[model samples]
Target: MTGIDFALNHMAAPRLGLADFFALARSLGVSAVEIRNDIAGTAIADGTPPGDVERMADRAGLAIASINALALFDDWTAERAAQAGALIDYAAACGAGGIVLCPRNDAASAAASGDERAAALREALAALKPMLERAGIAGFVEPLGFAGCALRSKRAAVEAIRDVDGAKAFALVHDTFHHHLAGEGELFPEMTGLVHVSGVVDASIGADGLRDAHRVLVDAGDVLDTVGQVRALGAGGYRGPVSFEPFAPEVHRSPDIQAALRDSMAFISGGVARPAA
Candidate 1:
């Protein structure tokens, strides 16, 4: 079997600046990294020039995997179009391959009828398709599995992408945490463009109760079965980046983040290499 191609998301080390973040990724021998707009004082949020980000990644010999996300993407509005355009422009300028599209995850969106949600999803994707194609970038649609998430299944995202004939410019982000929360069975490796891997080790919280604060680096105690998900994706024909995206405050505050990351990497690598039972 092919070895896992590991990538790092800024969320894994959000405290680091762009240059330092790129350096950290390189230090871990990680070639690709995801940059996020949500992080305060970061390039995207601080209005740093895309050229500067590109130069830093180039100096560090790292690839910008994808801009972390365009939130509430299914609720396309005039403002959303502007935001998408700007993000796409920046991603192209930074030489990034794709931009992540996060669907609406709120009570109202969740309350929508299934048919209504599906139609809205298709509408937004159809509108974004040409824009992404024009920029020569892929839209990585991430389905959040929270109870309030409007898009909770990769199967639904795939269907929407197909309905809009967006396969050429769109793909799915198979987030292990979200997958576990959604209780989804299909991997859809063929439609997957990226994979976000994180683990929940807290034994007290039920799957429904798990939150981003509970996310931490994958370890032997991980309840999310991240290693199994990775192995399944690989065996099913995914040869894409598997990115570390722990969101726990503890992980972000680790004094020795590099060491912690290395340990998680080793643990995941070892697990992925083991023969499946």
Candidate 2:
């Protein structure tokens, strides 16, 4: 079955309290949740604890799909590693399956490209392997597929994971948005760890535009051809949770987040039920 994980993007719903979000998730038939660390009221809501974020998830009876990501690993100074380690520890406490590591558009974008930068990312993750192992969480590497974006494909991300010797500690989040932006034709369905789905109104509103903000519902669009994507997942033998990561301002504007998410689930199941095998 295709499960849609609702994202708590602060920009989308500034007023939606975390408890309200839990109710919304239950109403929307979502058993899984992926919280954005950047959002208000979240654990580490502001580089600090938001208090009982994990307890809240427990109360909601939800499984943490994943953390959107911990950005900027290229500047792997000892101090920075300590800071990143804190986030990892929090993710473990929150019962998150993994933490997404986005190498592109990171705070350390200035150092996100070139072999040195890539190697630094590898080094950083390697340095954190012990801590991550102790925490028992996987590091999910997500590639941002855009021209100006530093990291735009799973290939480099895969290499980074390999270099970190993180086969056990790391996995991949294959976002369809990034997949299209990267113009990626290569398939590593077997390599796919987690998959994110969202649609854009205009193709031009792609990598350069509002980005995750433009993530609309999977209504009518080329991206909604998720059946092929799901088939690809099956072919790749990916059994991970597929998240409905819509970052649109309009979605949050909806008086009811539940209905919108249920619609998304229907679209996914409808699309994926088609045979591609």
Candidate 3:
């Protein structure tokens, strides 16, 4: 494994405003960050304007890695196209490297034919690639590992991207939490753009029962083998940021978030092995 490079995600500290979130990333010595559009009264949510977001990040000396996501992106409807266009425009304006695209992860989505799903995904990628290329932004397609998710494997995303000849404009988000839930042995670190790291330490719940709310910082108790996942990604030539994306309310409500984040970073960095000299 190579040395790990860490980044921060807004979900790790959801209560913080845009400026404060950037400050947190800087405080942890992380210069890159992923921002969210779902948070109310925040940059994208309050319509704070993309120019303002860019300026705010510049002032903080942080690179906006991505706009957290464009949800249900695989279906590729006209509405989704408009939504994607708006996010791509914002990403371009805010100097973001990419937009994270999350697929539909619901029972209804699961009911769709595999062929139908693949066709829709390919169509969506074909339509979005030109737009992303024009804006000089990469599309980070994150396959949800959940049973209900439409695209549950990184391999599926990779195949779709290849089908659309979007290697230049598309990449994958290798999420450790999702990977564990997905039960897939495949790892496409070469095709990855970002790595979302979080741990599920609750032994009471089986893997199938795990939810986003169960996610927290990696530690001695983590059941998902987060360190091993990082090691695999690194050994496979992935050199991107391993961003913290804890969704547990305890993490969100941490009275001393800085200390908590630092501890998690230490645990992750210390656990993953370093490559040979």
Runs off by more than 4 Å, candidate 3: 274-277
Which is the better candidate, 2 or 3, if ranked by TM-score?
3
Count of steric clashes across candidates, in order: 0, 1, 1
Candidate lDDT scores, in order, read 0.94, 0.68, 0.91
Q: How accurate is candidate 1 locally (lDDT)?
A: 0.94
- Candidate 2, position 161, lDDT: 73
Which RMSD does model 3 reach against the true structure? 1.7
* RMSD of model 1 against the true structure: 0.7
The lDDT-based order of candidates, best leading, equals 1, 3, 2
Q: List the residue pairs that clash in candidate 2.
A: 189-236
What is the lDDT, from 0 to 100, of the residue 62 in candidate 3?
A: 91
Put down candidate 1 lDDT per residue, 84-145, tens digits, no spaces.
99999999999999999999989889789999899889989999999999999999999999
